[model samples]
Target chain A: MERLPAFELKRPTSLAQAIEWLAATPEARAIAGGTDLVPNLRDGIGAPPVLVDLSRVPGFDAYEIRTAGARIGAGVTLARLASDAGVAAALPAVSAAAASIAGPGHRSVATVGGNLCVDTRCVYYNQSEWWRKSNGYCLKHLGDTCHVAPTGTRCHAAYQGDLAPALIACGASVELAGPRGTRTIALEDLYRDDGLAHLALEPGELVVAVAVPAQPRGAMSAYRKARARGAIDFPLAGVAVRLAVDDGRIAAIDVALTGTNSRPFRLAGTAAWVGRAVDDGLLAELGKAVQKQVSPMRTTVTQSNWRRQVASVEAQRLVRDLAKVAS
Target chain B: MAKRVLSFVVNGRLREEAVGDSTLLLDLLREQLGLTGTKRGCDGGECGACTVIVDGRPQLSCLTLAARCDGAHVETVEALAAGGRMSALQAAFHEKLGTQCGFCTPGMIMAAEALLRGNPAPDEATIREALGGNLCRCTGYVKIIEAVQAAAAAGGGR
Candidate 1:
């Protein structure tokens, strides 16, 4: 059996104490569910000396449904988010994204914050220490050269979180608790294109919770992911579509694509369809238009062109699904 | 390395032991306590061979640290049978030929156990969705679904 390297574990029960502990210990990594961090630690990705378990922190698992929107604690399990009645009814795209994550067992243990802040994956990067050592390591692990893009000086690892696209489409923001204080950032601004330092969070800061504002009155939400295999795999390409229809016409639509670029990318062309009546024909053109924004490299096992095609397919399917909703 | 006492209820029994920071719940069940029913497949979360019920939910044991299970209630496949009797789900698995490799049985049973406990009369789609995490390579899941449905039809474990 593969074993994880030994480290110090701290279980802080309060949020303030957790913040204090994180602020004081620069060598400590805050772990919510450990679904991503633990495996990565074992696989030799950032092996912090201490792991601060955030699962026991008070109020970390609360899923409070507000009048205008829903506030999901960072530590809330993906399973809970997927199954919560209020979350499903209010934000179907969020629910769908949560449910579509890994599988039942993973969703049971994986958390929303972790998913939002999951490490970027490159075929060259996520491997055992032995495999990486034998292959001379990639730029993601401080190696001199990147296997994905040998000419590039920086890492080209792809960010493949399932929730960010949907959350960004719904106009979500994250509350972060850090040593300095608490600050909230629009979900779109929280991420950078760099996979090595993907998040814009300062050291010792943790994502406290994510807030998804209320769905607009004429809103229709849907999330779609295309995977090579049927189950238990990450999406090769994913699409999250949130459409607002008013007076029997499209008020607005926000389309975000995942797994295709370094960071979540929203289609600027969605503005063109602001006041247009969308049909299957317009959706087809929109799908192709959306595909133009994605530039998928050889990040995962799926070919770049294949993933681009999938992005188009997913976009078309999403727009068609949104068109089904009665305006 | 720091060592901490992990006190949790296992199989309806309160068990406490000092676990290291790197100790996974799978190691605790298979090595320390001698409940080796949960097989470790893809020690990463890819495979569901190490599934267990933690507080009425089926989660991966490999991904869970023992120290994190402090004061929690954990149910492994070990607890499914009592007094020389197999659980209804186990009996159904056997009667319906649910195992060929027999490696994923424990995890499958535990996942199905949690589902049946929550929803006694789950339909085929529900059963399949509940057991979606558990993968049986030898048996292509048809018989496993049948076994779970059979168990549900047979009152789904008293």
Candidate 2:
């Protein structure tokens, strides 16, 4: 069994204490649920000199439904998000995406904040340190050349986060607390589109909470994910579609695709293709345009070409399902 | 490493202990409390081999930190056997041939216990979805699903 490397662990009872500890120990890393970090540490992927356990942090494990929007704490587990009736009713796309992540056990331990802050993954990058050393470290870890794309100048690691696309589609924003006071940013602003430097979060900053806007009236949303298996596998290509209908016509549409690129890609152009059109042909054309817009690199579990094809199919399925439910 | 003190009720008994920060609930049950029925198969949450009921919900002990269960109530597979006899679900498992190697039996039972606690009567689809996380290379899940349905029909371990 792989064991965590030697390190000091500190449990803080409040978010203030956690921030103080993080500021005090420059070598420390904050751990909320440890669903993502613990495995990385045990596998010798990345180990900090100190771990600041955030499980004891008060006010960080709750979900609050305000009149304007819903606020989910950083420590809120996936299971909590999946089972929250208010969240399910208000943000069905987010709830459905959470329910589709891993299994019950994993959902119980994995936190929404952790899932959002999860490291970029690729077939060659997620391997153990020893395995990487034996196979020569790729661009993501040690070496310079990306194994997936040899001619590429930078790392081409894929981001497989399940909730980001849905959250983005729902027009959610995230709060971050660091050495500098707190700041709120649009969820889409957190990603940099670069595989190597995927997130815009600073080194010592912690994601405090996420706020999801309430669904508009006459709006319908759905998430479709394609994976190797029905359960427990990361999405090969997933689509989250949110549609606002006006007098039985599409008023506005928001479409985002995951596991198809380094970060979540918004199919805004494809949304324009299906605007005000409630027919099957328009929906089919929108799906094909979405597939064309998503340039899935060859780093995921599925073949690049196949994943791209499924992205198109899944997008079409999502639109069709939403139209069916709307009508 | 600093050790944290954890206080919780386990199977109708209150227990307290000082454990390491990284001590998993599965280790606390098997090593400290001597409740060995909760087997540990995969330390990761992928396998349901270390499932236990925490605060009325089924959770993977291997993925749960011991300190996280403070002030929570936990029920293990051993708690199901009362008066030195098997519960109805256990009996159904035996009658329906739910176990082949028996390595995954304890976790499966605990998961089923949580399922029945939430929903006294679950259909075949619900049963399968509840036990989807629990993998059984043996039995092919047919007998296990049948056993759960039979237990549900019998009012869930009554």
Candidate 3:
């Protein structure tokens, strides 16, 4: 059994207090759910001198559904997101993505913020400390060179989180609080392409909540992923599709993908599909576009080409399904 | 940074003990309280061997901090037996041959207990989803599913 390294755990009663604590201690890491952070800590991935647990922060667990959209607190558990009636009604893709993550016990404790901020993974990077030492640590952590792309300078670890793609597909934005006070940013912009430094958050900054904008009338969305098992495994390649049909034609469509690269991104050329009818020819072209845009590295144990194919296949299937319902 | 005295109720008994800040709930339950029913398998969230009911929710004890459980109600496999008699869920697991190696039974039962409490008559798909976190290396999960179904059939879900 791997043991977590010792650190001071501070429980803050308010979001302001949590921000202050983080600002005061630069080495402090904010912990929500601790599902990913705990295991990473045990595996010697990080050694933060202090931990600010976010569970005690008031209003952090609040879930509100508005006419515009929904404001989901950072502390809201994945279970709640999956089971919440309003969330299911308004943002079905978000709920489906949350429900697909890990398993029931994990979903009970895993938070939206935690899943959004989950670390990028690579076969060489995520391992026991002893195993890493024996194999020579990767560039994402202590090592100088990346095992995935030995010649390349950039870390190739893949971001396998399921929520980012779904949320990004829905055009969500996140409210972040830091020493500079609070500001909102597009969820897509919150991530960078670098696996070693995936998040664009400033030092001591914390994600407060995610705000999902209102969906268009007649809109339908869904999220799906390929994994080794039915549960308890990260997505090999996850896809989220949101589309609306008006008068028997595709009015709008958004496609986002994860587990294929360092950052989850809304496919750029999806707008080209607008006004087109859902058919076998359109689906084939969509699949080709997806496969062309997504570049899967050798971060996972599975074949990178297989993941790329899976991502395209999933996107086409989801788009087809949602378009059928919308029309 | 320093150890603090934490108070929490386990199996209907209140306990106050000094624990390290880094101490895991699995360690606190198995080591300090001597409640070995919560087995430590992977010691990581990947395996649900240390699953426990906390405030009516099934959580992985290995990933939970002991300090976080303060003032909370926790239920382990030990609480299911009354007067040396196995609870209906436990009895179902026993009678249905759910345990081959018996290592994952405690977690399986605890997870099922939480599920049944929430949805008394969960269908086969629901049971599989609820127990998805728990891994049983011994059996092919046929008997485990049967055990949970049998318990629900016998009105044990209440």
Candidate 4:
């Protein structure tokens, strides 16, 4: 067992206190559900001087269902998000994504905010300190060159989050709180394409909650994740689809993918379906379009070609599934 | 660094201990309190060997900060069974020959306990998904799933 190094732990009962504690130490990090961060700490990936435990913070664990939308607290565990009747009924895609992450033990404690801000992983970067030192570490850490691409200088670690793609597909926004104040930004804007500096959050800013607008009638969403194992492995290629067709024409359609790039974002060519009627051929074409867009490197669980193929298959299946709900 | 006292209820008993910053819940339970039934398979959260029920939810004790457990209730595998007799779930595992090496038994039972508490009757797919994080290399999952099924059939989880 890899032991976590020595550090100071602070449990903050209030959000204000948590923010104050985080701002107090520039090296301090807020941990809602330590599923991701704790393991990273034990892996010697980071050694923060102070760890502000946000698990006890009140009022950040509720899933508030408003008239038009819902506010999902960042502290809400993935298990709760996946199993909550309101969350499942309101946004099944979100529930599906949450459910697909890791397994029961992890989901029960891993929070939505943790999933949103989960670290970008790579084959060369996620190993133990000793393993990386022997493997001639990548640009993600002390080394300069990327093992995946010898010529590449930047870290192309794939973003391994399950919920971010689904949330982005649903046009969700997040409430960010910091020492200065609070502000809400579109979820898509929170991510930068770079794997190293993945989040756009300023220093001391923390994600408070995610706001998901209510899905209109006739709107349906779904998610598909391809992985090597049934349980704990991260997805090789994940595709989340959202679609709504009024009468016979497409009202809206958004597709987002993760584990295929450095950041999860809305899939391109979705505007081609704004007013179009989706046919089986068009669905296959959409799959092909998505396949062409993906250029997976040798950084994930599955092989590069297999990842591309799985992406195409999942995209097509996702569209076919969503089409069933819409029609 | 600062040390804080963690006061939490364990198996219906109030317990208190002072812990440092990076003291894991596993360390608190096994080292501070000498509750070693919870195995440490992977100090990383990948393996479900260190799972303990915290406030009616199953969480990996290895990654849980002991200081964060303030004012909470935790249940370990030792809480099950009375006297020397095994609990129904434990007996079901024994009867079904669920353990080949017995390494994953405690964590598996704890996880199943949480599952059965919430859902007394989970189907095969549900049971499989629920225990997916728990890896067993010896007997495989056929007998383990069968044990859970047998427990559910005997109305054991509730």
- DockQ in order: 0.72, 0.45, 0.81, 0.79
Q: CA shift at A63, candidate 1, in angstroms? A: 2.3
Best-to-worst ranking by TM-score: 3, 1, 4, 2
lDDT by residue (B1-158, candidate 4, tens digit) is 56887789998899888888788899999998899999989778877989899999888899888888889999999998778888878989999999889988889999999989888889999898889999888888899999999998888663
Which is the winner by lDDT between candidate 1 and candidate 2? 1
Best by DockQ: 3
lDDT value, residue B121 of candidate 1 = 98
**Model 2 chain A: worst 10 consecutive residues (lDDT sum):** A269-278
What's the C-alpha lDDT at position A149 in model 4? 82
Q: Flag regions of model 4 displaced more than 4 Å.
A: none
Best by TM-score: 3
Q: TM-score for all predictions?
A: 0.97, 0.92, 0.98, 0.96
**Candidate chain B TM-scores, in order:** 0.97, 0.96, 0.97, 0.96
Residue-level lDDT tens digits of model 1 in A40-117:
887887668778888889889887886599899998999899999888778888999999888787888789999999
In candidate 4 chain B, what residue range of length 10 has the lowest lDDT sum? B149-158
lDDT of each: 0.86, 0.82, 0.92, 0.86
- Candidate 4 per-residue C-alpha lDDT over A1-327 given as tens digits, one digit per residue, 9 for 90 to 100: 477888888778888999998998998888888888888888888788988877888978877876598999999989888888877777888989999999888888889999999999888888899999898777888788888888876778888799998998888999999988999999989988777889999888899999998776678888889888878878888988888988777888888888877888788888888787778878877878888887678887569889888888898888777776777
lDDT of 3 by residue, A48-89 (tens): 888999999999999899878889998999999999888888
The alpha-carbon deviation from the true structure for residue B56 of candidate 1, after best TM-score superposition, in angstroms, is: 1.2
